[model samples]
Target: MRFALFSDIHGNLTALRAVAAAIDRAGPLEAVVVAGDLVQGGPRPRETWEYLIEHGWTLLRGNEDEALGADRIIHGEYPPRFRAAAVAQITWTRKMLGGEVLQRLTGLRESFRVATPAGDLLVVHSSPRGTNDRRGGQHNSAREVVDGYAGTGAAVIAFGHFHSNFVRATAFGLLVNVASVGLPLDGQPIANFTLATATSDGWIIEQRQVPYDRGDELAAAARNEMPPWPASEATS
Candidate 1:
């Protein structure tokens, strides 16, 4: 079976569209899975959310997704971690999404598991432990990362949050980080996703990157009064 996995599309509809087009060109995917951070930072929050909903892809909730339903600002949960600007953006995003959409966002699963002929595939926003684990698959050692998913029975584990795409093969299985579809921090101004295929021996993972016009996204941010887009990385 072949499937597409993408994540961290922080409301950049242009990037999402570009990635979707790339995936379409690849064709005949059995499933499309989004590992979350669906909306929150970029301009077109509602439209991005709508686009994902329209596709009916399997979605997982990231930490940013959790913030949509959190009363952080109301409870004075800003400062050290969340800044004033981030809070403002979240407030604006919530307003743009409204109650119904926010409810749906809140209803997303934290993690998803798919059983394939090869083995079980696990997808999550951060790591198998939880959505807030930002370290994910990148920071940890190969063995450490593989060992973290010890009893999950997943032959392949995929995730996105750090916005850095990579694939690691350990004695246990493959740990793939599909990376960001919107705000990529790997110094490449392109959207990214992973295509995984199951085989009798193991899973074949490919990291696909698609270049898109950033002009529209930047213009949208400016029109929405959003803060300047980061040159390298923003707190996701």
Candidate 2:
């Protein structure tokens, strides 16, 4: 099966559109997997979400999704490990979102699974174990990703959150990070998505990045009363 994996859209419609156009050019995909943070920070949170969801999406819940589950986030409730920046970002995001949007966000799952021609595939927003899990990787690190699914058996394990894309051969199995489709930590703002295909050898991974309109996204975020963040999730 050929599946498209995308994450951390963060309401950047231009980026999302560019990515989607790229995917269309790439051809028919078995499924499109989203790694969370569908809305919150960018040009059009609600609009971006509608496109991602209404189009083709195999979705997973991110930490920001959980925030929506709460009536109000108590500063003390956040983990001690979270940096001040992360906390501030969360504070701003909470206000930018409405109760209904939060309700939808809260309903997303931490992980997702699909039957592929190669085998069964698992898609996690952060880490398979938990959304908040941050596992570091590639250029940077984050438990929210690789570490979340320490022990797992699957033909391929794909996740996003770290914002860095990588493919690794681990003792567990074939681990691939589709990276962030919104804000890339590599100093590039282009979005990315991955297409995984089952071959006789095993799983073949392809990473693709799409360029979006950052100015439009930034404008949308500024219009919102929320904090100075990019997209969805606390990081947005």
Q: Give per-model TM-scores.
A: 0.89, 0.81
- lDDT, model 2, position 196: 89
Clashes in model 1: which pairs? none
Residue 31 CA displacement from its true place in model 2, Å: 0.6
CA lDDT of 13 in candidate 1? 90
lDDT of 1 at 102: 96
List the global CA lDDT of all models.
0.81, 0.68
Per-residue lDDT of candidate 2, residues 1-236 (tens digit): 78888887766677778888898898887888888867644545667767876885777777655654553343243455644544566555555566676677788777778766676788887666677655635543434334655566676788877777888766566778887776677646578889888866678899887765566655665676445532233223
The 10-residue segment of model 1 with minimum total lDDT is 227-236
Model 1 TM-score on a 0 to 1 scale:
0.89
Q: In angstroms, how far off is 155's CA in candidate 2?
A: 1.6
lDDT of 1 by residue, 52-141 (tens): 999889988988888888934432434655466767777888888999999999899988888998999999887888776644456687
Candidate 1 residue 106 C-alpha distance from true site, Å = 1.0
